[model samples]
Target: MRRVIKNDDSEVKKSNLGYIEGNSNNNLKISKILYKEQKGFCIYTEEYLGRADARDIEHFDPTLKGTSDDSYSNWFLVKHQWNKEKSSKWADYQPVLHPTASDFNERIVYDDGDYRVSELDDQEAINLIKLLKLDDIILADERKKYIQRKAKELSIYGVSPEDFFKILIDDDIKQISYLRAIHEEFKIDIWNLLPNPQ
Candidate 1:
């Protein structure tokens, strides 16, 4: 997963996020914005959203800290499979990071198209992965496909694998860390900055 910059917090759609809307599709509307943020990717596992894939509206502040779950900043859009797999938890069970508070690029690692903890002993982060099953074979296979396709596509564009990766991170494209994985697995470079976990 990558760090996403949320956009629907714009004043116009503020109502859609909470109190006034009372709409059943409130989550769906939120999903649309998040899809745009993630570039049609899942927030947890970084899987590209396909037509058949369904999204889930997750509350960041499920504990209702100072506000309801529907509160504007609390929302997140994830795949249905992810949502179902990750049930509720209190502070001790919180994910390794939050979109606003954590940088996935720092906490996550990608080599050989696999997302693992940058720090091997970061048990909390590892637990989060296990809880979400982010490294499952199904997701790994999808990520592998993206690695191959993106590597070749960029090669054709005369974009060096290094430049391709820096471009994605610089642009804040969602799942950037995953894209970096593709870079690591495909790149034959004797140069280019390696993925920074700092």
Candidate 2:
């Protein structure tokens, strides 16, 4: 199992990513979604629209007191750029089975007619790998064969079938623990539509 230090700043440099400040406590939830989906990236645009918009300045006033609109705009741009890089890497490695939609827009529309900014980072790559369950799914029959073939085509290192399965099971346990932490810290209903812990 990979021992990821929760406070590791080195990973920050490696991933070169930043997240929305208010959403830091929700990293586990975000990680879970990234891991389980084939696309390897997730967006909460609709969910965060009203809440992050500048028009609802009052909404963010509590958390972002004294923060400028420019700061928020810069964060949004960073977020979009990071996610795109992450998604592109996944596309280059795996089958195109999991396709992600483009969520970047020139202007964001919110109820208040104000724009919502985004944050970005490269740090989630490891978390995303564990979340996408690719380590496990790749061991399954069809997926395993497909991944092996693709790895060979790309001249990439491949995992043993035995190791792949083991990693999957291990990642599942780690993912659950991570999710629990996020739910507890953020007080969000993250498990509502997600699968029950196995």
Candidate 3:
């Protein structure tokens, strides 16, 4: 007896929804079409720009509004506004500068080494909290201890006793060297504590 074979063209066609291409532009075009179909609006600036051009919309430069200087400046303004609004909502949100500690100076000097331990105030305490939060090297307990020790050492410098407890919990630091490298080379405090190295 001969068996009849069922065709699976529909399933195959569904599986191959779109043709793959080695070129990035072809992929981008397919992505844009799919995105537009799903979301009505293209989130990608390239796709949006292309759409705008096709529609003959002038003064709709996606680059200018997406990533150029004008866009960046506008974004900065928006960010500043958001920050101000957030700070207003939270009274404790004080702005502190994160200057890279000098290599020649002590790795853990507070208040730029001018007032020593004698002149620390609420602001200084806040600053230390910011530094601790920014630095991934220190843990919660260690940060508290460091703040207390620094406060005591700088008590003569007018450090505040009450504000030293405003600790900010941080994510675990991944690599210890990551913090050191950033501080040493880039002069930036972008430490994120990771789980203990395996």
Q: After superposition, how far is residue 89 of candidate 2 from its true place, in Å?
A: 12
Per-residue alpha-carbon lDDT of model 2 for 17-102, expressed as tens digits?
33344674544343333333311211321111221322111111122333444222121111232243344354343322111213
Q: How much lDDT does each candidate structure score?
A: 0.60, 0.29, 0.28
Per residue, candidate 3 scores C-alpha lDDT tens digits across 1-198 of: 001121234332334433233555544443443333222211111111223333211111223332333311111111122223233333243443222222212323333211122234645334433432423233333434444454464465453322221121122121122222223332333222222121
User: Could you tell which candidate, 1 or 2, scores higher by lDDT?
Assistant: 1
Q: What is the lDDT of residue 162 in candidate 3?
A: 23
Candidate with top TM-score is 1
TM-score of 3: 0.19
Highest lDDT among the candidates is held by which one?
Answer: 1
Query: Which lDDT value does model 3 have at 176?
Result: 20
Candidate 2 vs. true structure, TM-score: 0.17
Instruction: Point out the higher-scoring one by TM-score: 1 or 3.
Output: 1
Please provide TM-scores, in order, for all candidate models, with all chains considered together.
Answer: 0.63, 0.17, 0.19
Ranked by lDDT from best down, the candidates are: 1, 2, 3
Considering summed lDDT, which 10 consecutive residues are worst modelled in model 1? Answer: 189-198
Q: In model 3, which runs have C-alpha deviations exceeding 4 angstroms?
A: 1-91, 100-119, 122-125, 128-198
> What ordering of candidates by TM-score runs from best to worst?
1, 3, 2
